[model samples]
Target: MTVRVLVVDDSLTMRNLISAALRQDPEIEVVGSAADPIEARAAIKTLNPDVLTLDVEMPNMNGLEFLEKIMRLRPMPVVMVSTLTAAGTDVTLAALEIGAVDAVPKPATATPEAFHDLIGKVKTAARSRVRARSDAPPREAAPQNYSPDPRHVLAIGSSTGGVEALLTVLGGFPANCPATVVTQHMPANFTASFAARLDRVCAPTVTEAVEGAPLEPGHIYIAPGGVAHLETTPGLTPRCHLSVGDPVNGHRPSVDVMFDSVARLKRPMTGVILTGMGKDGARGLLTMREAGARTLGQDEATSVVYGMPKAAFELGAVERQLPLHRLSSAILELCADPAVRSVA
Candidate 1:
């Protein structure tokens, strides 16, 4: 089925450019365009498009406010179009938490490749499931009997629908949970803001990974995007290392790079591959499993896109596949198990 799209942006040039790019995909149709939220509301009611491309900054009202209203009143798949500035990145991350399906940075100058990428995001967003603004799944309370091992490190990787997925999983962690590392596919400017948001909402402290930062319990480190791959160095003090290198699997700070580095460490580890569009982390997860680390993958039923987890499962890298809501509990259980810890 052809995906019907509504373009909402204050700039006529942007609307035209977005529309032109999406139209290049034979499966996508530009049904309408709107200059502001007022116009967008009307277009949404009449056109009832399959997907929406919303600009983060608009004339009458900002995109964030409008997005909240839409998600509350009528939940639907929405992709945010934002600039690459710091302020824009912050707002875009907020939009994702408010139930937007995904986001794309507005190109400074729309090139053929940029248009192709935009078109691909729109197509993926059209197929994604958008939950209602208030429809969060009930979280299980932290297990009273569980105590995490100080020597255990939890490493996670995700893409596409990861912002909310990571939020759901990490929000369930206890204040004194195990030390963790994450390599989510995000832009350079967005990682800091993303980490800040996670810090506020999660029980464990979260920060963007820094070079030589000591991996400590109860703190979570996120790999900085676009700059370097997050890796680990083995020694008396196992610390986070950022390495500048060519993009692996078409991504800098690739999940494979992080997982492979974690595999080299002497301490016990747990690897998780969550919802994403590609198979970037499959091989690395396999390496972790081969090194006696417990590995988990998010199951298809709960995944927005199952590509990464599916790849890991098929490769025999993931020992268990669980739904989104159950993953946090499973991680805690694995961490507390003496049998699992002995493999380290």
Candidate 2:
């Protein structure tokens, strides 16, 4: 099936470049173009495009504000066109949290490599599952006075629909949670902003992993999305190791790389595979399971894209599968001290 797309950008050149690039693919059709949300809103009703390519900054209203309205009233798959700058990444991350399917950096010259990313994002957005804000109930809070086993580390992997899913799961973490590491596929320019966003929302002190950063409780390290793949140095006191290497599983900060590194660690672990678009985390989760780590995967019904978790589940990596709401409780339970009990 062909994916009909509407291009929304204030810049005429950007609109044409995006439309032309998308037109290169046989599976995607450029249905229309709109300069702003007002125009785009009208185009949506008339063109009824399957996918919408939205720009970050527009004339009248901010793209993020418009995106929030779209998700609340008329949830649809949207691909954000963002500039590669500090402010741009911040707004783009906000758009993702507001439920855009994906984001791509705007190009200076419309290079083939750049448009390749855009074309891929358009197709992926076309197939994404977007639910209205009203349809998504609030995620329950983490168990109160949760006590974690300091000897255990929590490793999580996600992509595609990960921003919202991670927020749902990590929002439930207690103040003093397990030493946690995550590898979420994202644009290189966007990771720092995303890490900052996570830090503000989640209870733990979240930061992008740097070389030699020690793995410890009450802290979450997110693999920096770039040339370096994050690894753990082997020892009683493990530290974050940023290994510059070829892309594994077609990603620099590949989930498999992080999981494999943790699998070699002496600490007990619980590996979780959440909503994503591919099989990057499957084999790694399997390795963790083989090493006696409890493995969990987000269930299909709760996943915006079921690819990663489904792959992990089929590979015998996942010991349990639960909906998004229940996943946090399960993780806390698996990582909890057996003797610690909290009253309801």
Candidate 3:
């Protein structure tokens, strides 16, 4: 089926560029174009496009405000067009949390590669499952007075729908949670903003993973988005290790590489595969399970895109599959449990 798209941008040039890119995919059709949210509303009512390519900046009501209204009132798949500037990056991240399927960085030059990324994102968004803001599923309550075991490190991997999913999973963390490392598939420019956003909302101290950073309890480290894979070196004091390598499974900060490294460490840990679009983490999570680490996955019902988790579950890598809300408490519980306390 053709993925019908409505291009919404204040700039006529951007609307044309995005339209041109999307049109390259024969399966995608530019159903309509809108210069602002007011016009976009009318188009949505009339054309009823399958997906929306939204601008980060708009006239009258800002893009975020309109997006919020759309998610709350008429939830649909949206791919945001964003600038790579700091403010734009933060705003795009916010858009993801508000339920935009993905974002494409505004390019200085309309190169084939830049448009290629946008086209891919648009098609992916077309197939994604979007929920109204109010239709969020029941979430397990965050645990109270949680005790942490430093022996157990928590490793998580996600993509596609990770921004909102991570916020929910990490929101359940207590002040003294385990030393947690996360690999969320994202653009290189967006990871820093995501880390900062996590730090603001979560109880633990969350930061972007850096070379030689300590893996201590109550601290969470997120893998940077570009060339380095985040892993921990087991030693007198476990320290974060970032290795520059070719992209694994089309991702640099690949979940597979991190999980494999953690597996090689031969330590007790928990591996979680959350909502994502690919199988990057499945094999690595299996390696972790074989190495005596506990493994978990987000169930299909709750996943925005169940690709990675489904693959891992099929491989027998996931010991249990839980919904997004139940994951944080379950992860913490496994870490604190005596059964998973011993080293491999």
* Local distance difference test, each candidate: 0.88, 0.89, 0.89
Which regions of candidate 1 are displaced past 4 Å? Answer: 110-116, 142-146, 337-344
Better of 2 and 3 by TM-score: 2
Model 2, 150-170: lDDT tens digits are 778899999988999989989
* Tens-digit lDDT string for candidate 3 (1-344): 89999999999888888888888889999999999999999999999999999998888998999999999989999999899999999999999999998888898897545678888787778778899988886655556666667677899999989999999998888777888999999988899999999999888999999999988899999999886999889886678999998999989999999999888776679999998887999999999999999999999988888899999999999999998888977888888847443211
Count of backbone collisions within predicted model 1: 0
RMSD of every candidate to native, in Å, equals 2.9, 1.3, 2.6
TM-scores, one per candidate: 0.91, 0.97, 0.96
Error of 1 at 187 (Å): 1.4
Judged by whole-model lDDT over C-alpha atoms, candidate 2 comes out at: 0.89
Q: Write the per-residue lDDT of candidate 1 for residues 259-326, one digit (tens) a residue.
A: 99999997889999998877999999999999999999999987878889999999999999999999
- For lDDT, candidate 1 versus 3, the one ahead is 3
Write out the backbone clash pairs for model 3.
Answer: none
